[model samples]
Target chain A: MTEELIIAGFGGQGVLSMGKILAYSGIMQDQEVSWMPSYGPEMRGGTANVTVIVSDERVSSPVLNEFDSAIILNQQSMDKFEEQVKPGGVLLYDPNGIINPPTRKDINIYTIEGSKLSREMGNTKTFNMIVFGAYLKIKPVVKLENVVLGLKKSLNERYHHLIPLNEDAIKMGQENVVSILEL
Target chain B: MAEVKLMKGNEAFAEAAIRVGADAYFGYPITPQSEVIEYLMTAQPHLTTGMVVLQAESEVAAINMVYGAAGAGKKVLTSSSSPGISLKLEGISYMAGAELPAVILNVVRGGPGLGTIQPSQADYFQAVKGGGHGDYKMLVLAPSSVQEMADFVEDAFDAAFKYRNPVMILSDGVIGQMMEKVIFKEQKDRWTEKELIEINGSWATTGKTPDRERNVITSLDLDSHKMELHNHKLQAKYKQMEEEEVRYEEFMCDDADYIMVAYGSSARIAQKTLNKARAKGIKVGLLRPITLFPYPTKVIHKYTERGVKGFLSVEMSAGQMVEDVRLAVNGKAKVEHFGRNGGIIPSPTEVLDALENQIIK
Candidate 1:
């Protein structure tokens, strides 16, 4: 099955990097992927978003209409993309950022206090990894080993020291996955 | 050996053009495509032996410099975004008329008047239909990946020389900024001393042509017949190119119940939409055209005979390639269109919905 997802937030939130990690994981899995982001001014805090599509076959479109899943890193993201998620879709929220939580029963909503968790993990930047972990527990697109490989492939060769802690963040997030769907 | 590295489309293009032995670069800075010049500035890009890089006064001056350099038979290139590309059209027309060889790159952005700086496929008609004046066509190459962005550098140069024309690499801002792993090939061929005859010899306008013959490269043939003859010659070249250069990617089209037609960055979007459609057992496939001018007409038409349902032309423009799709489909299958101009991208959901509403019906 092919999974199409969108990650949205303000600029400098590393939304694009999150997509990169997922896309890289897809590459390691031998799945076809295309990660596309808004260019120019959108990167300057004006509602940044990226769309990543992973499929068993060659991907056709980089745009998505009905998302199987989404990661809302901020309140703006939740407000904007709340209408687009498909029924039976997965919505992972950072509880510290989202102002209005979802009240949908047909879809799965996971609210993780990623900011606190990431800060405790020694680097708030690992918020992305925490969300990735939750997705791993629920969706499991890539094996843990392959994901580490993808991480090394994406991370800077100079900053290899941060790899171990990022791995811990993923593990922690995976264990705390929140399920908010009747189904 | 040319080492391969993961690079953005813009930087890779600059690297590729320089590697292909381009002797001169003339351009002004513009977003999305700004990295092209940015990379050039990092390391002075020169011809293998000797080349020149001139940051022109404006897009107009840049294209004119291209006109001058290419007229002299020197490998010259320039790049810009949609607004800048529009300014270069006049120079593009001049190049076409003078039978000059140059490579022009358009890192497309949303347009119509200083549109958004985002990636856009909206310039399809501007590149294909000759956005400039008079009767002419630019050999437009639409590259979807960083690899093609690199590989097409050589192809564009060769195509320019082979046809005595200007070639444009029409890329969107997304393609320009997106980074990917690329494997570079060994570059062994380069412009030899023999290739510099017209550029460095007595052929250029040095006022010395009067002794040999007037080296006038003008399209103002007052005689309609002579001008018609020239036009006829360009037509023949374009026809030959269409036969030899039509390139495209056909994905899962062997048994597709329906086909989607898209190009450049939009084709990538189409790929994602096809996957979603396929998961629902829709039997949808994609036809991604690489060469915008020498469009893969025959390959796209092949889908019609075997109950290929219909074609959905997804572009960033209103409906340029849609016309070509209709012509290729030839009433065998209905041709529909979906577009979002001014820098907006059509969501994959919207496209699938369009496909369901227009084609699957």
Candidate 2:
């Protein structure tokens, strides 16, 4: 099985790190993975995006024009990646700063109030883990145990104490995500 | 599995350098590849492996530092992007003329000037055709994945010392910035003083001794005849490399009608194109050249002789390696170039469309 995903948001939204964690989880499950980010000056505070591919076989390309799923955090990303999602794919987004929500009709659309949930959890930094957890819920390609292992691998040991909190955030996302359209 | 981890390509290369027992790393920060130096600094190889990691004031100074360390029989390395590499070219030429063994990395960006910081394979000519001023050819290895980014570090050092020539890992910004799973090889210990004497003592300016004369390292020769002889010697070593070190990978070529020749990140994209084309009943294949300097000329000729219809040379440049592909084909098959400049990477379907328009039609 292969899953090509794009996670996009404003800089410092943990877009790249979320993709990195997903890639590490793929490695934990003995799958091939690649994470390609749109980086440069635009990353100062502008929109940032990353393409992540996880596959049972060797991944052929890291850069792609289309994605099986899109996790959009900001309006800029939602507007940019809405049409890039393949038909019959998933488009998950947190309606935090989004002025223009996705209008695609051929793909499944899901919304999670990531910002609202993270604020309620008393940690705004857990926003990315919430979105990531919601994405995993939509498509359970990797196991939750593997996701925890991946978090351990990607996070520094000094921050290991926060893994349990991040896990709670992810679980929150999985439970609170609302499916808007299923075609 | 031996210590597999997901790492960015530039970081992987830096980690591999420390693991492969490189004596020193000297580099300046540049966009898309600054992580090479950043990772080295954070890892503190100087404290862990006793490897020196210095952020030079400039790319030129970094390369000269590489030359100095290499002349002393140290496994030295330096890395930069397109503009920075241009600054390092003179020092690179001097090292090549002096026959010093060093590893240089050019994580290329789109350029004629400062250009875009995004990924591009525009430095193919600069890399394989000797970007520096001299009659020299550095062994160039193009890595497509983070794994190879780590793996080629050991291979490049081996080739550099074997030929007493500079070796370059020609990676683009895509490979430099992208993250992938990499399995590192066993860590190696740096060369000892006695080992350095045994391995590179004949020419390296290690030290003057009572039994052995002081070794001199210089690229300058006032005598024209002597300079011509030096050029010939360098040419001979390049020829040896061509014969022995050409590396390439072929996919679905045995029964294909068309061939897409690419390297590095372009090759990775073309592999996806190959799959798409095959699914659509188009017989297309890919031949990815691993060593750019060696050029893989004979292999292209072999494919031509085997009745491949045409070749589509995909790069991230206006067209550089395409010229080499044409020369290798020798008019045996039609060769066309397709690319997007200014740091835009073409998609798989776009490449396949170019193949159909430029080659198949």
Candidate 3:
């Protein structure tokens, strides 16, 4: 079975980081994974996204055709990718960033007050972690311990200091989904 | 010679350049070819061996730096992918026009624009026929393996110096990324540069010395007779390189009925295709080119004469190698092509299927 996910938003909204966290978690679980971000000039203000595929075997291409699940952090991304999600796929979006975004009754949609929850958890940028927590609650691709390990592996010297805070944020996301959404 | 070590093609070029004591390396970053710089970054430049490394602002600047370094009587090298290489053409032509000696390593990727980053041999024409303007030829070397990438360093520099011309080591993403064992020869310098450009002293400007004016290295010859003589001299060097530097690898082709020709990463896959054909009891063999500019035309024609019925030229590009195969076959053997472009690498299974269509089916 293929577990494909696309995370999109404005460049600095932590969308790519969330996608990479999921991808690295996939890797930690011994699942085949591929992650590629749009690196062109349009990345600054335009929607930036990462396509991630996790599977049981070697992935043929790093590109995605139809996403099995997706997340959007900004209004533009939500509007752009609203219809791109596969039928019966899962979609998680930040409620604060989107207004009048179309709702699909056929697919599962989660509108989380991600930024608010992140601020409550002591970091405003941890909205991505909240969504990650939501996805993990619904589809546990890997264990919580494995996500930590994956994060550590992907961190470089420059970002090593942020690891503990990031882990706290991920735990907050995982816990917030349970207490708030009853997920 | 040294013991074999598994290496990727880009790293192989890096090792080879260092082995050749290249005075400097100037380049810009692009995929598939990025490993060239990555390797150099990991293996810092050692100045004592005459290595100077710099990451240029752009490919244009990189190649132009090559022009300057080469003019300084220093052996120099640079590398880039398809689009970046295209940007370097103006400087490349300038290098050619001025008859500068340097090695250009291109880890080719699919392209017309900023295409997908995949291995392909589509740049054969641009490289061999001269990517820049005017009637000139650069000695182009197409290496099929990491080993060849390493080995061709001497050949590349030697040929460049021999002809007072620029030489290129053209490889693709497959060759660049694929890891394989290689045997590196004891690093040797074939030509000692008296001065990067002054090595060939027909210069109108060098440095004003007592008894000598200056040595200016350029391609501008206003007088027709002078230009003709210069052209003849360059042509003579080309003829010499054709005789001495043309190289290729042949397999079980002597009594084979069908032939396949390819190079770089595609050639490696073609080898596997030949194996699959042989397993099916088909008398098929491969003619893999190691040198692209001075293409191995004679060797291919040899197979044609020995009752070879058909040939298939496979590549990542649409039909770059097809033209050369047709030239070699010269209507004697039926030729077909199978390929993909824009960074899509052709698979061995696909090539075997094509072989079946033309030869078996």
Candidate 4:
């Protein structure tokens, strides 16, 4: 199966890096993957997005229009990507920044208080990991073990000490995600 | 050394160049391709293999630096984006005229002037038809994926030296910016002084040997007859390349009714569209030109005889390669063009729709 995902948020929210980590995890599982970012000025301080495609077969187009899933971290990302999720697919979002939640009834929608949970953990930088936790819990595309290995490969050795905390954030997300639809 | 790693396309290109033991690299900074120079500078190949990496003042200066190094019998390269590459056209022409062997990487972006920083295949005509003055031809290699981005560096250099002319890696922003798993080549040692003297001694300006006649590397011939002979020599070399160096990939064309012709990033997108069209009970295939200059014209012509009904040339430009497709078809079948220029990448759905509306209709 091919999982085409779009992760979007403000530039500093680690949206691109999150997609990179996911792609690396897919690679670790011997899957063909591609990570393509919406680069240039949009990555400076504005909303940035990356398209990550992980497949059991060769990935054809790294750049895509619609996606099987959309991970929205902010309202702007939600406003743009809500309609892009394929029917009967998945939509995961952070409730903190979203004023109007997704209204798509055909797809499965889930919410995680990732920003608030990460803030409560006294580390706001772990916001994306928290969201990723919820995503894996819902979709479970790549194994959790592979995600940890991906972190080890993607992060510098100096940052390796914080892997446990990031893991904890992911667990917190997995435990806290509220599914809004069964479809 | 034959290791597998997930790397960005630009960084992989830089690493592959180092592994291939390139003697020198001169480049100016530009979006989507700046990572190439950055990675080379950070890796500092000079300390490892004595490979010199210098950031030139401008694209013109960078290409000229490559010309100078290539004249001295060193394997050299330079890279830039569309507008920056435009600035290097004069130097590129001079290198071709003088028969200097060099590799040029164009991580193409949208352009007619200073266009968007996004990906584009708009430079197809400029790259294959000669971007500068003179009736010259440079071997053009179009890489469709990050893996090809790395693999083509060595290929480009080899082709450049084989013909004693410049070669271009005609990549677009998508191949330059995307990240994917790549298997790197094993390291090769740089050429020794003895090897250089043996290989390039005949015409290289490597400080004229004492036992041989003084060699001069130049394209200038004042006499009309001699200049015409030089032109004929270049044309003959180009004809040889066309005969021997044409490279292409055909996917699902055994019983295809329609074919999509594309290169670089557009080719990747076309593959996806081909899959979609096949699922909808349409017999569509993809013909990707790996070498743009020595185009896959003969292969395309072969399809015409095999009952292929129509051809769709998809690009990131406003119908540049479509003309070539039309020529190859030679009135045997219909040929149509579909594209999204000015940095807008056409989606698979749009391409499929175009095939249904333009070609099938």
On lDDT, the leading prediction is 2
The sequence of per-residue lDDT tens digits that candidate 4 reaches over residues B26-111 is 99999979999999999999999999999999898999999899998999989999999999999999999999999999999998
User: Each model's TM-score?
Assistant: 0.84, 0.98, 0.65, 0.99
Interface RMSD, model 4, angstroms: 0.8
Better model by TM-score: candidate 3 vs candidate 4: 4
Cα lDDT tens digits, model 2, A56-116, are: 9999989999999999988877777899999999999988788888887999999999999
State the lDDT of candidate 2 residue by residue for B73-153, as single tens digits: 999999999999999999999999999999999999998899989899999989999899988999999999999999999
lDDT of 1 by residue, A14-91 (tens): 788888888887777777676767675656767788878777975555556668888888888888787788898888
RMSD in angstroms, candidate 1? 3.9
Candidate 4 pairs with clashing backbones = none
TM-score between predicted and true chain B, model 2: 0.99
Query: Which portions of model 2 miss their true places by more than 4 Å?
Result: none
Off by over 4 Å in 1: A25-31, A40-42, A137-139, A143-157, A168-183, B1-6, B43-54, B179-181, B187-195, B198-228, B251-259, B272-286, B297-310, B328-333, B359-361
lDDT of 3 at B258: 89
i-RMSD of model 2 (Å, 1 decimal): 0.7
In candidate 1 the C-alpha lDDT for residue B101 amounts to 82
Score residue B68 of candidate 4 by CA lDDT. Answer: 92
Tell me the docking grade of candidate 3. Answer: incorrect
